[model samples]
Target chain A: MSTDIAGQAKKMGYKNIKVYLEGEPAWSKAGYPLYASNDFISKGNIVLIDLRSVEKSEAGRIARSVTIPSATLKDKADSIPKKAPVVIYSDSEDEAVSAMKVLKEKGLKKVALVPGNIAGWVKSGGETTSGPVVTTIVWKRQMEKGEVSITDFLKVAEGSATDTVILDVRNQDETTAGMFKNAISIPLDQVGNRKGELPKDKKIYVHCTTGARAGMAAKDLINAGYNAFFLNEDISCKDNTCSVTE
Target chain B: MQKTLIKFIPFLIMASFLTTGCAQTGTTVPQLIPQHGTSGGSRIQDRPYPIFVGNVSNVSNKAKVIAIDVGKGADAKTHLVKFDDKTKGIEYAVVGHASIINYEMRGGEPWATVIKAKLAQLPSGVTEIKTTELKSLLDQGTKFTLVDARPAKRSIEGSLPGAVNIPSDDFKAQANKLPESKDELVVAFCGGPT
Candidate 1:
């Protein structure tokens, strides 16, 4: 398999080809080193670079992985080190390969790309940095507003507030297995279609297995002229009705 | 008689002229061939995938182009292209079927290559490509938003990154709340078969 790769490179009339295994499963089952684009390269004379946008990098990135977005590589080529072994990775291999070329042009000789992207690395059991959880734009908004905890939502459900509406934004398949008895399922993708089904008079409380979808739903309801809240925590509606306190 | 006959003949000829001249033409003529295959017209888009163009090892060529895989072992029907140039490193085409894949940059051009599929074409709704390893990258001050399209409750923990919660149910009503700027990187995920 490797033999043809070199030949293919030669046929394309190029030298210095770096190889990446095609798929994540294959790479994982085979057991390989995978890391995020911004994976911390504190040791091994390796420099990890995060090619995601500045916003993503700000949220979290590998330790020491510089922010060199794929789009800005040409302008920022001089920053990379020539002596160190560099490994490029991203969720998108297309971006990773593009960045690799930018670096080579800057005269960095020792460079390679990760087989699978950061996701592949994690699936393959690699360690990484910890940071704040990302919330949906709606969740982010709710978090900013400081209203209702997961526990609070549960309390309302358990108490049977007549005016409250518990909306489950998970897909139908998820709801089929069982969900909060008081909750009505309206999947995220289908919300627009079923807008009429939702009650405008009710103060809606939204949720999902985790809080992200519920946050988004609550945000949507608020945007659509309905007052809504989200559960800050993930609640399992199985065995017993999940309450905010639980 | 001769005078009347001549007057009648004139009238007959005039009527014949009117009848023949008033008839509508209904035939279509072939138009000229276009000068170029797509002069003003758009190039037939690269098949659903972006083509990956890059350099291979030991070859003294400009750049080699390859079709990238859209999904896991899904075949090369819709591959995104990556261009690997020694001088430019790697640069991808903006108008391909696949989404722009990002990687680390070295110098002038990129030598190696990778590709990403379009969001709609991603293997499944729940394909968590970067879940296992993106956490630390997030820690490095790389700010990115991972969106859980699941309901808020399902995504309280075990998210790939500090993922935002966007319920698919309310995505449209809340689309306005999403980042309006293109510069903001947003990724959406669901708990489906990805």
Candidate 2:
């Protein structure tokens, strides 16, 4: 993609254009700290930690950030989920960098620093909150819109829901490997023509390997005046047993 | 002239009914009326799936989803498409840019099967820099402008030290951020080769 930009620069009458094709990931992997954008720091689903003194945090801290002073971070490191993308900031760049290294050593991947720390964030027009800092880490995964909840999908798959039908939209060849006994197979391309075969009164729940095809099938069914929803998740079924990952 | 008009009146009425019939059903009309071939490759093979050409309005890298603006003005509609490892050419989708998407629909949402960016080829004049060479230049205090060509958000997350951001999408408007001397050596990079 950077090459695309170099192309534009060349067209704008610039003679010297060189592309660093390896880009940001390479720089980051080589033990360098990356600066989190104000937007991402403020809005992204990540754990924002303040590694400054508690007094400094009480004076002001980024909103939604948990207070884990760099001095005490080692003891509380186990409490932080390893998978969570962590962003740490402090008044001092060295302090933040060291704290990030601590997390990296603890096997916590995706750790980053706030550029210029809190001062950089403030300079970039980012807002902060001043009060007793939040010490406990609280995080939850947000679901996308139009996705059927995993609990509801599992209920239907288990045959506990009398009025719901599991519509499997995988190809016939795929179904031969394994399929839920309750599911009615209908390849996606044929759904437009065969939708009438399904009962309109029953709620239709759709699924495919990775939910892409199921999503498409659910849309076609909904357009055809059926009460349909799609499970936007990964699922595998064999011998009447299935596993779902949320 | 009146006699000729009267003879054609029945055919005009039939055409009006045909259009209204499609409007009333609003189902599979796009399939019935094949669109003109706008992309390369076999038109007949791609006939079953509708093609959308639009700017990428938003991209959620974490969520692995992108929204494309397929309409204009009052008629504008944004199609949210989910992309996974199977999605072809998805790495080229940058926010606030345009790409050609061949998609399938579910509940009126587009799921992109393939995404293609225009002008993917590197221009003849540009030179490629290796990571080690760029690092040596930074260490040696080389006198050159290092441009981060990724979006502002990505660049902020982490970019090379001393690199100025000039996102590819807004390159034309932000070109002034580059050095004034046309002869000045400028190096650019993005979220590479992913």
Candidate 3:
């Protein structure tokens, strides 16, 4: 896509075409700073960390950012969820960069630096909160709309629940190798015509090998007034046993 | 006859699903048919040279090989290309990050000549920007258009503060978003090196 854009720019007679090939991932990995849009900084599901001293943070800091001073970052790293993107800001660029390295070394891949640190955030019309600083990092993986939790899906798969039915939306050839013992086979393309075969009272859980087709099937079932949810995970089954991975 | 028909119904359903399912999903069923073709011939000599672009799935520095995952889902395939001192930007081929590799067939395997996080070959007259230069430009509030060529979803995650999104997928349609002057300095970036 970047190549395509570069070609399009060249065709338009743009003389000075420059491509930042290493782009965002490289930039962030190097501890170079990034600017999260105000909306995302305020509302996005990210672990915003203020790396300023407790005194400075208590005076004023970006709203929703947990105060984790640069000095104590190494000790507090374990509390930070590796999956949630960590956005940090500090009094100085060096401090923030060091903190980023600390998190990265601790195996957090999604660490990012807020440009200009907290001062920049305040300068850019971002909201702030004063008073005591929040030190604890609290986060949970939020499910997308119409998605089922792995726990719930496993319960149904394990036959602990009888109120829900598992719908296998993979192709017939895929299931010929193996399939869930109680699952009803309905390829995604045939779901519309075969909707009447499923009971409306029972909750329908749609699943595919990689969840793409299952999501589509879930949407169709949802529109058809069936209580449907899709399992958004990689699932493989063989000999009546299934393994699921996120 | 009734019992036989009942037993064969599953096969009939399977046949119908294979035909209709593959058609609708645009995914081919993997076939295990034996091949009956001449061996020891130039497989790609007549075909246009292929360049594989994808995220690096694995990098075996010890083995001097990089495995790239191309395509997605059912059509996905991995290409293991051998690299050496001649391979450019080998350091940037980090795992799970984008890389572009153009290779030559060596002993029936692809041997990478160039491995880059960006285009394996840059268009003539175009220049590449180092990360530091971009950072300095943004810091100085340079009067140039910083374009985020990545998709909208990625840009939303985070980008340069003043960068405008002109996703490469919608470049032509969104040309108006670029500066009006053709001579204006424009820098475009995407998810590192793709």
Candidate 4:
């Protein structure tokens, strides 16, 4: 998370940055005012979101949580308040991390992962409703950690191989600013509806400005039976030279 | 443009009662005028942000070169800043002038580089004047336009006697505050020697 924050900062031309260790989850666990669910429901300057399914959110949620679902968050970047604290939660930690990537790419500030999901909030003495919990089944193939870290992805990207394709899932404005040589840009919202355009034969590597959208998009492509995995990395491109963010 | 000058006329009138106060020159040299602000200075004039306040000590179009003197009385350093199309015809920085900058290792190093780049591109004809020299001119009641280069808060906190305060970090948009009379002397100074 520190590397991700530092990477984002460096890309924005910010200097002299210091990263808080383990960030909000650690801070909240230390009992240091983690924006209790009840407190979050009433705040005007905050955009609290449950990054779960509409069906799951309908079952139970902290009041005022707008449901955009984890998969479709990439397309709704502008809907999220850039200046406010964007608190996102899901069934698990990995789900929240995925939503965080999209928020980071949008350059939103004060984004935090809720210490635990709604379940964690209840465990930490916060309030929650009892719809039990409807967990989404991982019927689709998912990318396990270390299968494609940023480092390994970069090696393949820099290598001279026509078989491996880099799929950029960022929006048109982002891709217009810059894009890798021969990278296919099928934005996240369009991927579910436009799954046919994704290549099946190639070793498909997905990415966004940050990896959240790519992570979501990768799951979609893989579920639709395409060879794909999202890179947990930052990518910047200038002309023909596409480089990884440090 | 004429309307803007018309607006400034009233400010200039109200500022007549104000006196010239001392300011930092960002140099080690002893102040040249100590007896100037007997009443401890007056309200600074109304100026836009990022433009400074001070009196012109020197203006040399014939020389067409920037002259800076920074450091202590004896070990004071002098350098010539080149003026071109980008610098808006300024002669010199005239403050905390350094030949080689050794920026602090913290995040300020990038800003030092940015500052170096920006200093090279200051608006044209915008020469900086030292605090002491401007104070000396003010003591003699020299008919010159004064501008407070620092922000409004800095001026309110206690500023040089008769300068106008401009908001900090917003200079280029307010360059019109300079007097129309080329013969009239103008100087802008702020945050000296720090």
Candidate 5:
């Protein structure tokens, strides 16, 4: 947590700051119970993937963590959600960073690395569950079912002017270049929390710079009871005029 | 029958980015997507501008933008917010990060209704003092607590001449270390509500 942590407490009506020099290590040594960060596991919404081998995960792992391993991430690219904040951990810091790139490439929105990994978790007194190692890797079967084609999308967006809404699921920095003619910009990271803003009166069409994030958002919106579909193709825009392909 | 549908790639990846454009006659203005940073951030504005920082109320589970006070205690006025990415980086959460939304004072539409409406207040036993007042107090040698609510990583960069370092996170846990005097004028502060 950055000063933003303190900023939040103050915002919530707090008034002081103290220092713990030993940090998590000393607290762990003292047998203090270390808990997962709020952002990672709060509300059972965050998805944690263990990048280490199956043997390592089975030995002892953080509760509710999934397994995708760094190398095989490409194979399961569509499994992760674009808006949900995801935590990727492994045996070492290097492995975690390597695995993070996989998600970043897919534009999985906000991703973070757990510094301590299994060792750090142990040092911090986090409970270690050793068993058959139930995994959280629930592969999303065939997302192309809800796929929207470029021609079909252009038709809805520009065609008969039906009740079709274009949802853009990219970040603030990326949109400075420009956007689709009439799509709404609700960043992929905040889509889940901002679902209320989405209009249910129209047929929703979600898209991103690449189709990676759009696919994730499509799945999410559909599950949430919205008439939504993802434009699973590459698209670009400048000065409000966008060009779509595939 | 199994069929493979291959979609071409690398045609400008852009959507929902049009800030200044006219939607066709059939379409409406950009409604749902709040182009937050694109607006007031790039516009010429004075420092210490009005910025609302809180969960977007009314519409539950979403973060909205209504920067600045509007007579009502709903949103807060801007204070010295230390939004340094190095020492004080932003953190993301389910609700979203500390959204430092900047907006040019529009025609009193945003502040009238919606979003956070609670007046931010200082915690009990805490009183806010201005930098000038603090300096005066230091010059007059008024004995008081000048606690920097920042973490150790930030304090190492150097704090006030005599301000005690106490990261706000551990402040509650280390309450015993604070002055035992119940009457001591305790002043607490940190990167004000971002």
Candidate 6:
């Protein structure tokens, strides 16, 4: 059998395994499509269809996969464009192969299976989308002149800038001890919806107890084309000292 | 057929009422369970701040529970879920790519108790803890080591003093660099606990 031929041929039983070795590197080197798992088969120019349930899809799903849960695929198959490339995937390749056979039997052409299914795709570094694609304008942080430290953010809080927006990305509990006076508190989860409340024209500064969350929120705002900066140091109401406890 | 339709209509109405009414009342806050140790050996305790169960998409299967620990109130409430296969309503599982938050106990009311109490006081789906609790914990010498779960480059420029760098991507290959003593307090955070 070709499967065990390589081992047998090592002892000069047969040379059929040589062909597989030759083809393996060539395929990868030439940038031919590689399946992360043998569960799904893939062909060029095929639409990748994810056959995962909705709950699983919510956490995330294969990138660009047109999701149609396997249980509902029969009824929804018609919703897909018939002439386009069709590649199906599920938890395993069996379902994809079955889907391909059924589609072919139904006189549909241009159908294939994703290699190794969704699991394989994940193993191969494919990305998936999480939950509803809530739109949030992303903004990047630009350190201002002489504003490299948390102390700078503190200065801005103490009436240093005109019409500046201080956005506290920390959760309510964090602000309970004491947030800067007149600062707007918006939990990161709600930032996507509350972006409208922020002044796009004003210089915005984001802060958390530590700088990580503030930095992330700042990046998101930056990607959204807003002028935002993350406070680089920890500033707390516990004491006048801007340094945070490690 | 008419009788069946009539019989089913009330049930459908009741079902609709249950669904919509529940939605109006708002999502139930899943019980938060804090873990005392690192992500690998973290055992769920009856504590709060470090662990929170939000986005209760399903509650039918307790084994299928997908609860997440976003981080302390000082950080953003980012989505992070740890899966238990028997949990209800979890038809799929996603291992969060973000590194798990390694929380070191900062005393106070013990994170588990505080979380349960706070969840009751706060609005559903909202867990806002007062800073006093955190400060109290901090005062107890329940010191925390904020491990930067990013690369060396990011950790060097801006890192919590004495904070160790343990990039999640390199965790497996470089797990040896970590302390063998599991009892040592360490808090690992990456991208809001991802």
Residue lDDT tens for model 3, B1-194: 34443443443334222221001111111110001012212322332234565667666554466766665544545556677788777886777565657678766557787675523235667788988898898779877888887777667667865778898657889988888888888887777554
After superposition, which runs of candidate 6 have C-alpha atoms over 4 Å from their true positions?
A1-148, A238-246, B1-194
Ranking by lDDT: 2, 3, 5, 4, 1, 6
Give each model a TM-score: 0.28, 0.55, 0.58, 0.26, 0.34, 0.27
Q: Model 5 - which docking category?
A: incorrect
Instruction: At residue B154, give the lDDT of candidate 5.
Output: 36
Q: Please name the candidate that would achieve the greatest lDDT relative to the true structure.
A: 2
> Rank by TM-score, descending?
3, 2, 5, 1, 6, 4
Two-way TM-score contest, 3 vs 5, winner: 3
* TM-score, A chain, model 3: 0.65
How does model 4 score by TM-score?
Answer: 0.26
In model 2 chain A, the worst 10-residue window by lDDT is A139-148
**lDDT for each residue of candidate 5 in B101-154, tens digit (9 for 90 to 100):** 232333322222122211223333334455555557666987766555555643
Per-model TM-score (chain A alone): 0.40, 0.63, 0.65, 0.42, 0.43, 0.38
Model 6: DockQ against the native?
Answer: 0.01
Give the alpha carbon lDDT tens digit for every residue of B55-142 in model 2: 5656654345676655444444555576777889887676545466777876655677888652223567777787788889987988
- Residue-level lDDT of model 3, residues A1-246, one tens digit each, is 454566678889988788777777777766665666667778888999998899999999999989988878889998887667778888898888788788888998776667677888888888999999998888876787889999999889877567899999787877887888778998765665678999899999889887766776776677677999999788998876788876
lDDT of 1 by residue, B6-111 (tens): 4433433332222110011011000001211223433222211212221111111222322222221212122212245532322322222222233333342222
Model 6 lDDT, residue A185, Cα = 84
CAPRI-style class, candidate 1: incorrect
Better model by lDDT: candidate 4 vs candidate 5: 5
Candidates, DockQ: 0.02, 0.27, 0.24, 0.02, 0.04, 0.01
Candidate 3 chain A minimal-lDDT segment of 10 residues: A1-10
| Number of backbone collisions per candidate | 119, 6, 1, 20, 16, 36
Candidate 3, TM-score of its B chain? 0.49
Query: What is the interface root-mean-square deviation of candidate 3?
Result: 10.9
